[model samples]
Target: MSPGIPDRRGLWVAVGAFVIWGLMPLYWHLLREVPSLQIVLHRAIWCAVLVASWLTLRHGRGWLREVLARPRLAAMLAASGVLIAANWGLYVWAVNAGHVVEASLGYFINPLLNVLIGVLFLRERLSAAQWISVALAACGVLWLTTRYGDFPWIALCLAGSFGLYGVIRKFAAIEAVRGLGVENMFVLGPALAWLAWIELGGDGGFFSLRWGGWTDLLLVMGGALTAIPLIFFAYAVRRVPLSVVGVLQYIGPTLQLLLGVLFFGEYFGPDRAIGFGFIWIGLAVFATDGVLAARRRVVAQQA
Candidate 1:
């Protein structure tokens, strides 16, 4: 199913996930007083628990035993595990540092990054419009860096890590839920060991939560949110065309922009405006090209 073929339900669900992710700064801000490392720990631990429970319930203990039996698959998942964990860590850090808007910018650039990855890794070709879009977006980013006297590290890190993760997962070949479950399982040992160390140390561990009761609750929500998106995304990826999914990704960054300006009080500089303007024009060209291309295909098929 392509965007050319209407799908209100899937569109809504995909949009919903992006909305939640965009508004994450609001939720993660509550944990600002907490250490970023502790936040990562909670995200990893709770997300692992949530996915594990789902797997156990759906496939029983046998599936887990099967994962254990496949040593090579386990190793591949372990590598993916680290990549996603790093992505999450970078995101959390960005959210905590009042860089949510920049983080959103990263995602806005991600589709173009995907296009680049396709060209580079998958030997996929981009149209002239697509190449121009990439160049414009890159120039926008560079303009911001020159104007601000520093690079948008958060934006670049978020996009680069995420884009690379998607590429890696493309090669991983595991089912969505199972893949996530395996990735979590691969990291569980190290996470548990870290928690254990935090507990035994004089610094405190399990009970040393900053928000106390609410922290655990939020952590659980984080895990469920983390796991559920993959389910819909996985479902959508299979059922829908890549073009549809690509278009849907913009919702997340749009939400974050609002959050940054409205909630976080980030100033909208003229340079950013110019940069974003370039990006908008570029994407407009790219999307128009896609729409026309899709239409031509449909018309040809009909003829």
Candidate 2:
């Protein structure tokens, strides 16, 4: 294959992954009948199995052994694993509990959160436009908080957990899929125990209940749903430019917002609309700044 062929393929692959991620709330919604915690447990267990099997098939036993042997790495993975599990559980719960719109809002602000984290913890400098974008997003969030008469705990929690997960993963030594597989391993035991309780306590929906074959299939397929996009995403990042991937990342939350309003019929009154508008403006500025900066770098290199 030509060198450019892989890049072209990766673009499509990345788009597919983002699209899948964007529509994931719909998948979670299908399992709304099952308790969110139970669904999360199943997701952890099944995804671990899938990723482990894939790792073994690709790299043999050495990969797994190596991951386990590194104590420091293992510790980081464990922390990251817990954060991701918490993120997954909460997102699923939010979707099932009809908080999809609020959940979407969290992701909408996540990029800005990353910027904030960079400034606060890493002492990174932001451009003037970037600062303006962050300020607009902050104002949007503040408006929502005041209008609701309370903090948006669900949105904040989702953003915080996922942001911290990214931070931990940044220092991790393992590769992406392998790292996720290892992370899954850390959570597997608790997930299994929880599943056991649900099944043995006669309160489970997997086999004992009369849910239906479709539900069973969907639950089993949750593993694929979880891992496939990550695999596609990993593949894409290796082949595409970071800026391209960055822009595409918005697809997930946008799809989620649409699903929330159009499909789930969640509230989108004028007040929330105004708040989201400010945030969108912030994202527009942030994205435009990134594109312009990237373009300037390219031009400088050419010059």
Candidate 3:
């Protein structure tokens, strides 16, 4: 049987990556003692150190030489670097500010936003169901705004930042590790400069002198976890269909929602649930359309 064609392992790997990433907010919340800007700075700094070390081990000093050889690629990836930095900073800020649940909402909206990005930026056509999905998600967001007495800015920010990252990465051609290396370098300048100034006697409280002690060494693994899954995702993207990957992304956001509501004990009330309802219905439509369209393709092939 050969395990029935292990086709979705790559999809599963990507999903697993999202799950870990989604639940990461809980870990980020622990560093709440640090300013969100500083925490963002740490994410970029640690990511740079981790990726640089990997490149050093793999390529030795020539890693720098390789990067210098591709100045155009480096410049393009620099844009990706800014995108992820803003995404990281916003996510950490959201979690620390007690908006984990809303942050989950942002991820919920990401897929729908991706569709729009495709249409607007790439001039791609949207299916009827996709148009409906976008409308439903927008309506849900609007509903959340109406019920909550304010718009869910955290959710919107999360969706917007990550969605933009995806858009830019699509245009940037480079290997995963090399691309990430350059992207991290984009924020490294501002991140290191900010941290240095804070360390010079400002009240930034730069280092977590008591931060979970040696356990914080595990915290440094944050970059590894971040990068490894991305590598897996890049592999999976080439192997799996985008439609499958899109649905699988829900698993990660779902885990994040659970972690936010259950583990972190963030509040989730009726209005938010209603918003989730709208998003779910929209996904249901989008998924059904994709499945049926795939079936039609198979039938046409046979015909």
TM-score of each model, paired residue for residue:
0.91, 0.95, 0.88
Kindly list the per-residue Cα lDDT of model 3 for residues 50-83, writing each as its tens digit.
8888878887867656766787767767777887
**How many residue pairs clash per model?**
0, 0, 0
Candidate 1 lDDT tens digits, 1-303: 433574667767777766777677887888787767767777888888988988899999876678778877777778889888888888888888888778888888888888888999899988999999999888888888888666988888888888887887788767888889988877778877886787677543345554587776776577777777777776666655556666677777888888888889887788888877777777777777777787787778777
- TM-score for candidate 2, please give it: 0.95
**Highest-TM-score candidate:** 2
Off-target runs (Cα >4 Å) in candidate 3 are 1-8, 59-72, 202-212, 215-219, 298-303
Tens digit of per-residue lDDT, candidate 2, span 1-303: 432224788899999998998899989988889989989998999999999999999999788779878889999999999999999999999999999999999898998898898899878999999999999999999999998665888988998899989888888966899999999999999999989988888888786556787988898799889999999998898897776777888898999999999999999998898889999999999998887787777777667
lDDT of 3: 0.77
Clashing pairs in 3: none
Name the best candidate (by lDDT): 2
Where in model 1 is the C-alpha error above 4 Å? 1-4, 65-72, 208-210
**After TM-score superposition, what is the CA distance of residue 251 in candidate 1 from its true location, in Å?**
0.6
Local distance difference test values of all predictions, in order: 0.78, 0.89, 0.77
Stretches of candidate 2 off by over 4 Å are 1-6
